[model samples]
Target: MATLSPEMPKSDDRKSSKDVVAKLNYVGEMHDRAVYDIRNPAGSNIVWDTRDVTIHDVRPHLDKFTMDTQGFAFVKLPSKFAENPELFEGNRKARHFVTDDSLDVQYAQEICDYIQNMTGARDVFPRLGGLVMRTSTRASAEKAAWAPPAEFVHLDFAPQAMQGWIDKTLAAKPRDLKPYSRVQLFQAWRCISPGPQDNTLAICDGDTVSSDDKVIVDSMTGDPSIPGNRWDSRMCHYSPDHRWYYMPDMEPDDLVLFKGYDSDVPDAMNAMHSAFQNPLGQTGVPRKSIEARILAFYD
Candidate 1:
């Protein structure tokens, strides 16, 4: 059962004066637990029923949220690809289908370097296998091998799942490697398509999220018979106190970094995010974006 924070302000009190309204899907009440089986060829079987609740934008109060405080921060750091698209041919080829070999290694390294510089971590590892490209346009979604925008409000990984990844990663390194005092998982997201996105990504403030608001679900892919085909993810139960925000007219140069998990900080804010319909309607091209998962180690 998700509990609302008594100290938090009511939803109505924090409503944006701009009248931006959209529906966000959240885990609905269920007697049995939920599971996401992507192995189903016909279509993914999402046993976790969801309810779409009307939510208002919090852009007017953007100043209230910060990377350290709310676990997400938006920036306008332009990518090299954005400046010189012709220089990275692999990035262009990725529009069709993204694979470890298809994505440019240089591009991935650049992002890793950017994250390292921004967070000042001793080391940063990019999960190349976790790189994903998503689109919202119907034509593009069908033609491209990429996935559509995710509509559910949820966190990417549960604590145990993240810990398992960390353990596995550390185990693969040399025995003589120095031990890190802290580790953080983050997702760096950016728009790849045109501006004025019709379906934008919205993030929930971590401070407003109660620990009880999360439900763990089995996130499965590929063959169910395979041992490594499953991992745990978190789904959120709707709460009135959850504050959501989104950048209105994001460009390809814009980037947002949000925390997924942090070691040595049990109560650290973990940004929960989802894609929602832009209530203002489609002003430009349908949203197409890329996201990269990164792990930062601090000694």
Candidate 2:
């Protein structure tokens, strides 16, 4: 169960003294289990369970936050992506990023190289990557060529899904001769804006989350019929001990690295994350960002 407050914090409130509103996944209904069918092409007939809105005083708990402890870290790295910014143009890939264009493929590969150097992984493989833009309604945002910020408490992959992805994605690679026994999946996120972000990302401490609080669900692409297996994503039930943190005034050069799945130990499990509404954000220009999902093999 979660500790909730009815009071909401104002935009001008101080970070150390104020509370922030969080839209959390609520799963106390009288159902055998929670599941939704997301297999639709026109962005119609989508079934996303309703979430509960609650105000929380995150200031006091901010002291407990850390990348290793929370499964996320804020790292500063300057990149030359602005020289080829058009690589993210169009929704041709739709919903999620599809790597078809040669330029887009090159861009993803470059990101994979960056991840390898950042994490010092023995080997890194570039997987699916995409740009998410904030536009229109929150519900309709994912279907847009430029998607909206995902405003919910969730993890990108489940254990089952993570295993399947590893077996399939690395089947052709040479066997590991090193003593490393596991693989880790990471998502590198960054802002593409010229200034500070009004809507920013929030991360939850994975250590505080128990197995029972995680609800595994399928995430279907816009076209549900092509490759029928549903992609796995975990919806989190709120808890009082769950600590959340975010980086304020982010620039394009800074990257937010987070663990999506780790095969080695429970302590290094996936990071729970969501985008929150920052009242202090500057208006007129929406937030633009890109996220790259990469796999790192450990020794």
Among the numbered candidates, top TM-score falls to: 1
Worst 10 residues of 2 by lDDT: 1-10
For model 1, give the 10-residue run with minimal summed lDDT.
Answer: 1-10
Candidate 1 stretches greater than 4 Å from native: 1-19, 39-60, 82-103, 137-142, 167-177, 225-228, 266-269
- lDDT, residue 188, model 2: 75
Q: Write the per-residue lDDT of candidate 1 for residues 1-299, one digit (tens) a residue.
A: 11112322333443435335678777777556567654343544444445444444544565566666688876556665533433223332332223344344445566778778777888787643445666675553323423457788888787778767666555543234358888888787887766667777888888888878887777766564653356788888888888777766666766777888877555443698988778664656777677777888888
lDDT (10s digit) by residue, model 2, range 1-299: 01112111222334553345545544443334444443343542323444434444344454444545567665555666622546455432454444556554555566677667656778787554344444323342323444456666777688777766666555534345355677788787776664445566777667767777777666664444654245677776656766666665666766777888877654343488877766545452456667777788877
Each candidate: RMSD to true structure?
6.9, 7.5
Any idea what lDDT model 2 has?
A: 0.58
